[model samples]
Target chain A: MSDRTDPPGRRSTGKLIVSYTIVGVPLLYGLVATAIKASQLFT
Target chain B: MGVTQLLDRERTVAPPGYNRWLIPPAALAIHLSIGQVYAFSVFKNPLVERFGSSETAVAVVFSLAIAVLGLSAAFLGPWMERNGPRKAMVLSAVCFSGGFLVSALGVAAGQLWVVYLGYGLLGGIGLGIGYISPVSTLIKWFPDRPGLSTGLAIMGFGGGAFIASAVSDRLLRTLAPEPTAAIAPAFVVLGLAYLLLMTYGAWLVKVPPPGYAPGGYDPAEDETGVEARDITADQAIRTHQFWLVWVVLFTNVTAGIGILEQASPMIQDFFDQVDASAAAGYVGLLSIANMLGRFVWSSSSDYVGRRPVYAMYLGVGAVAVLTVILIGASSLAVFVLGTGLLISFYGGGFATVPAYLKDLFGSHQVGAIHGRLLTAWSAAGVAGPLIINILTESQRRGGAEGAAAYRPSLFVVVAMLAIGFVANLFVRPLAEGASDEDIGRRHRAEPAGSPG
Candidate 1:
């Protein structure tokens, strides 16, 4: 049912980037922090 | 329009040219926020100290949260299917954040029961609703790649705890020199922060327009041919396939949580050189594996098909445990790697089930089906720990030490995984006739525009 002829315009693209960033940063932060703690295993 | 009108499913339908990719992030926001429940253990000692209460009393708060999460999800699944994710997300935000604020007050007032009412009862409802909110919508949006879509969202659930664990420690350290004093204000801050993030999720989430599908995907040509029928939640429960998958999940979770519940102490029991700090690192490694596996294995299911992928999760996972039983004491690396592999499978099992349900029963009510299936998790949450603890304790009482103390429990886990592998084999595609009729009956019963 989506209108494929009408592509998501510039503002929509910007919103996508911001939306991903909002969730992405925190997840990345968690991964990095957990990785740091996990590094203790090798030590 | 009023707020009620704004939150309705009709208002939340995807507009022309809206990128389907936006939905995963919105899904992630809700998952990440409610996934904080995984880190509730961080509060146990502090609360115990604050209330001058026993450790078991503090622990009951978590048990209640998980129990209520399962019960509420099962009971509310129909409501969620009817109302749509945006409304559910808003309600989830209110309950989850409000749980924290109310618990904060309870902490200040020294009422353990009030904390139980707030965090346990209210927040558990938040966990239940927020969990299923985005699932069926994601399936509708990504009909061709249900595994990948659901994985992207559920992976957030596994990862949320790591962020929350770190955040809680930092806040507790900074807010008050005495950690006990910090519990109240910390809850307030966390509640407010999660409310903001979850509100963003509520605002952004949208249901796919009716009959929406991704641009290039075709269901008739789908290689697996698993997305066969639109089965209602009630109809789904009556099918043998449903119970088989339920058994599959229950056994898989029971096996994995055996290691998880005993991770820290078990590592030391196995390896003499390992200390508490190193044990903590091992637990962290498992957490990383758990989080990563949710994404990796579930995404792989999109390619390989759900049944085969779950076969790998249980079958290969059993071998991973066997590796620990055979050579684990000989090498620290072997023990960590083997258990870590099994835990990854465990995480994958959790992430993959929603998509699996979608494949078997269709997306119409997959979220509700998924909600009902989580009772397996709730059951395993109890059964897994009890099995491991009782066996390990009895072993210690019988004069066993080192890995010997845990060997019996480890064997039990291997058997559980083997059972799950068998259950996974028994799962068949839903039978054709009854489901089609049920769909017709259910549709007529439903009002127009209902998700189901």
Candidate 2:
């Protein structure tokens, strides 16, 4: 099921983005760097 | 009352329109952060130089952390279950990130024991709690697809090393101009960062209300043939199946870790034609494979079943190790492929074990049982490196050449895998009424709805 607004146990889009940014920023940073290192080693 | 009330699992039932997809990302937020524990070695050299301690002394920190991880996961299993995943995750977030903050101070002051207390002791408990908290909740939310759901989060743990190794290196280089003095600030920053990430996970995590399965999934059709009885943590340890799975995990980990802990050096030692850079590349490739196998093999187990999947891990793993031993490093491709496949199986063993637990024991306190099983990992962590290092050293002393140096050690791993294979064969269903006795005991012992 999906909800638009004011749902129980479901986070709002703004809240979701805040949570994602907190976790995603570091993970993305690391993944991008890993890609760079992989390229350097393979190429 | 507000944050606590929001965090209370009883108060957090999903809305009629709650989307289950949001859960996996919440899990990943914690797993990926703690998985950075595997990359703790990135700081090994810097730590050694900074503290004027031997590499062995620095290594003790990692070993101690792993030991604590197993011990706490096992001992704290019941408490974690009673409190719920949300509370468990919050505690993990605090201890793990706080360990870094404390260890940072230890580094700045050069008090090595305090560093051990911070990262090794406190951080290890964080690893244990962070690991088991999401497991039961994922099974509850995705009852029809436990393997696939758990695999997604576990893969995040495996991938954490890639993120941590890369990010920590960049962070250290930029932040620490006085390289030795850099560890403190780096620890502070990283700790704060992980706290934020894991707190988001804690904030987001919610246990599905009892009996809430996904729509269109028949609880009747979902029968795994394993009886749906509630086996408490205490009863699980008393069962033959638990010990057998423990041996299976220990051997699988020992064999795979024997290769992983020595991947870089073993590659160079085996192939004189391979340079240092090439060996590093090989090690990197194994890390990727290790991460991939966590997702692929574990997800596949849902279709093939946990037993057959594990049989493949143990049986095929033995063959791969044997291939390296017999063939030596004559063909670079074979060496790489063989070792890489073994690494995949190693990761697969980790990803598949929880689903196996769910099969043998019912979902009731499965998280607690899972925590107990991870003790095998701590044992294997020590055993793997010790076995590899000792055998290789003795071989070198006996005047073994290049690839010949690793042959004895690799064969030893094959023998270990063979034992694991035999143990997997002995894994049958738990005896009848074992769950009943435990459940009855729990009912008499505690108030309704309290965790086992």
Candidate 3:
């Protein structure tokens, strides 16, 4: 079994930010779009 | 022998691993079921007749399923990695099967929310988990052939819809004389079959033996000169390349789905002068093209390299979309050919992405990255349908003439593919510092010669 203790790279911080950005931006877009559509449903 | 020796012996004899052959079957089970999403149009006319609901309302179920697929995969990636694929596959099968069961009950009771909850939310979970379960494992087993392995597994996903479309159509025709009643039992039967198939697949999976490697493989001999890395899922999320890839995937998927959502209508519109039967035949041909592209074009990536292959997908795909616009309703042949090529590239994009991930990030955290990136599919699922629906609805309201309304939507797809092509151009080899350290660490830490 490989040792679990060794820290890999701190660079993944950049990746994490980018990932969240990529995931979050479109997600937020979808939510806003859905909200807009839902509002239209009632109107 | 001492305990350590005994443990080592056990590791050598039966690695905490799954049978490689089992992965494909498990993948097929999940894919075949979730592929039903593509057949939602079959139910559209029926639902309108029975429930007195609008097209938009019925479409929401599909949108919800797709949206949930990404959400579940994003949230579930780490858990899947920790628990192993077996647990993930089992959970997926159960949720997927249960979704159908719930939807059946909902249909019987005439409740829309139940269908949404059952098929959309629960089935979506199955879609996400089943989608990702076999990918990383297949790559691990065939490290020397990441492109081929991932392509084989994903081909099943792309083709699943083709199978589901046929099966569901037949079931609808033969099983129940009425639309609403016919679909509920079909759901029940399909759910039970998928449960059994997925369960068998889950049981068949095992991690490869410690120190096991495929025969005749040497990392140093490869031209990509790409080395394996041991980055954790957490570490993988920190790189710019990962997010760049995410964008590429997002654009590609969205572009394809945009066309897919509007395929039948678009074909009929373009071929308005032609017979309806001919137009329907063209639609079926597009589906076949999509299914074949998943295997043929993606498998070709194994030799041509992922970057060049994706560049073709975007560049050619853009032209294909534009060709549809240029041709308008003038020539049914041009429209059919263009639409077929677009669908092929769309399926090819899905099949090619996992290999591209392996190329950039290495196989260590590929499953996680793949899982994370699948959020793009979810996003595209929503975007593609919404863009087409909103545009088409507005065009109809404005009394846009035949084929002209579709022009704006096709342009949107073309723009998206253009963006994806640019992203593909931006792709380069991962930084050496990152690549080397990852390889060195993983190499040393690996238990002997095990398949990654």
lDDT of 1 by residue, B1-452 (tens): 89877899888988778788888999999999888888889888899899998999999999999999998888888898888999999999999999999999999999999999999999999999999889988988888788898999999998899889889988999999999999999999999999999999999988887777677777777653546566778877766677789999999999988899999999988988888888888999999999888999999999899999999999999999988998998999899889999999999999999989988888888999999999999999999999999999999999999998888988999999999998888777643454577655654565532333
Cα lDDT of model 3 overall? 0.69
Please tell me which model should have the higher DockQ, number 2 or number 3: 2
Worst 10 residues of 2 chain B by lDDT: B443-452
Clashes per candidate (backbone, < 3 Å) = 0, 0, 15
Scanning candidate 3 chain B in windows of ten residues, the lowest lDDT window is: B6-15
Runs off by more than 4 Å, candidate 2: A1-32, A35-43, B2-6, B431-435, B438-452
lDDT of 3 by residue, B186-218 (tens): 888878977876676665455555444565666
Q: Rank the candidates by TM-score, best first.
A: 1, 2, 3
Q: After superposition, how far is residue B291 of candidate 1 from its true place, in Å?
A: 0.3
Q: What shift in Å separates residue B210 of candidate 3 from its native position after superposition?
A: 3.3
DockQ for every model comes to 0.60, 0.25, 0.02
Among the numbered candidates, top lDDT falls to 1
DockQ of 3: 0.02
lDDT of 2 by residue, B1-452 (tens): 67655566676566555556667888899899899998898899899999999999999999888888889898888888887888889889999999999999899889999999999999999999999989988877776678888887888897888888987787779896866777889899889989988898887887775667676766656555443677788877766677888999999999999899898888888877667776667777888778889889999999998889999999999998888887857777788889889999999899888889988887788889999999898889889999999989999999997888888888889999999998888888654444467545544565532322
